[model samples]
Target: MGLPKRDQQYHTYADYLGWPESVRYELLDGVAFMMAGSDLAHQDIVGEVFAQLRNALQGKPCRPFVAPFDVRLPKPRQSDEQTDTVVQPDVMVVCDPAKIDRRGIRGAPDLIVEVLSPSTAGHDQVLKRRAYERAGVQEFWLVHPTDRVVTIYTLGQDGYGKPEIQELVGTTPVGVLENVEITWDELVARLPKIEY
Candidate 1:
């Protein structure tokens, strides 16, 4: 039904970068994993959230970016032989211009968002969440299409403590971002829908 799990090895960001545009991938624990692509519904959800962030942050210091963008968080041990992992989040908000490199966003992004798909559920909810928190990402949002809701994780000095889960039924109160407030109803209703 699906590909078997293998111990995929990667050397550097260059190695991962050399991959063709046909596939999406990520490096975890110094290993390369082939992640499945998202369906139409997932893309729609991501686009909706992306639009909200874009609209809200307009004329503001913060800028929103969609992925296929690489984010590299350096580790303590710096050796040429050591593999540096690079990740492409579904969406991200970066307030720091220094982190925005020619290649991709390089340091801690203010907000990281992942639109969940069946194949990436475990990684998004667990591994990536832990990594983003460890990197000092201020916020993390995971949008689920099937459940029709979004869960947000905010980082604290201690750690990524917990998430503020919001159930989106018809209309709900979305969180405040960069001093701007938007409702869940407006987001869902205005989200660009795919024409069948």
Candidate 2:
């Protein structure tokens, strides 16, 4: 699917807050990108990933949140109107309690997961990845539902290091989070079978 037409005027978090909640969007460098609804497979993967993260984070300080949760990436000392970027990752694990508020996350999350959808794959892989890296997200995962593969990126001194690829065959340890393992085969088995 194609992206929404570019608006002439740049948008801010204040403007985003006032927009209708029925429609979903993300602001990147003051530009708005409309978000498309996820399909069954995408939703299933998101749910499973969230469940796994949630289970691992149980009794821990870090917490997992699904999409539609605002993650405002603001510059230091910037107000809501001055803040331009606001994104909603498929699943985010925020370790800082201070960042959690009535609105949403105020800064970068510890880990972000973006499950690929046909409409938003490009943005997720390129634009969002760069933005997340710039915002200092520690770990980023790009999950391809159709291919049943996951590409993990870890932030380093220079930026994100080489991506570590993992196929959805067996259990794989989540590198960023200690002792956390995702049962890939179980997740794939539980996904709803779709016929084209």
Clashes of each: 0, 0
CA lDDT, every prediction? Answer: 0.71, 0.88
lDDT of 2 by residue, 57-163 (tens): 99999899999899999877878678999999999999899999999998999999999988888889988999999999999999988788999999999999799
Tens-digit per-residue lDDT, 169-193, candidate 1: 5543333254654356655654446
Q: Report how far off residue 18 is in candidate 2 (Å).
A: 1.0
True-vs-predicted CA distance for residue 158, candidate 1, Å: 1.6
In candidate 2, what residue range of length 10 has the lowest lDDT sum?
A: 187-196
Off by over 4 Å in 1: 1-7, 77-83, 169-176, 186-196
